[model samples]
Target: MTTDDKLVYMANQIARNFEALGHDHAVAATEDHMLSFWDPRMKARILALAVERADALGPVAAAALERLRAGVVPRPQTGATRFAAVDESGASDAG
Candidate 1:
């Protein structure tokens, strides 16, 4: 997938987890995650995607991004990918 699409997918995955906390909390958590883990260039890229193709994002992710764009910059943190690891034959380790 293109990096932009990957960003969207990643954000949606984050949302799926953060959503358990509730919508407002999910938005806050997502914003916190992006601000903390994503570098400026990555943030800018996703922000650009958020503006240019919001519909491409999942519902919670889109909402979270909107909250981020509206102003909620948190400090940066070390990043870790949420994508599942694939085994030799390409099956996700999740299964």
Candidate 2:
């Protein structure tokens, strides 16, 4: 898919996953809660991570975004855990 298409697709996937996890409100509140501490490049990375790590809310947003861009579908959130796994190399496995 085109880069924009991929970004929008990933965003939709993240929104779906968040809703599935009972955090629909948080997803809705994203525009309000989003911070602006990073530069343009870092901000893009954070947006990308938001899609990959739909379960987590922390400094790892950039990593999650990169993973999604690489075609990885993060592990579904379950139990008491809220974050998906980061690979050994700090990247995410696409499987």
TM-score of 2: 0.30
Best by lDDT: 1
Q: What C-alpha lDDT, on a 0 to 100 scale, does residue 48 get in candidate 1? A: 91
Models 1 onward score TM values of: 0.71, 0.30
For residues 1-95, could you state the per-residue lDDT of candidate 2 as single tens digits?
66645544544454454554345343432222222122466446556546654455432333344443455543333323233456344333343
In model 2, the clashing pairs are: 48-65, 49-64, 49-65
Q: What TM-score does prediction 1 earn?
A: 0.71
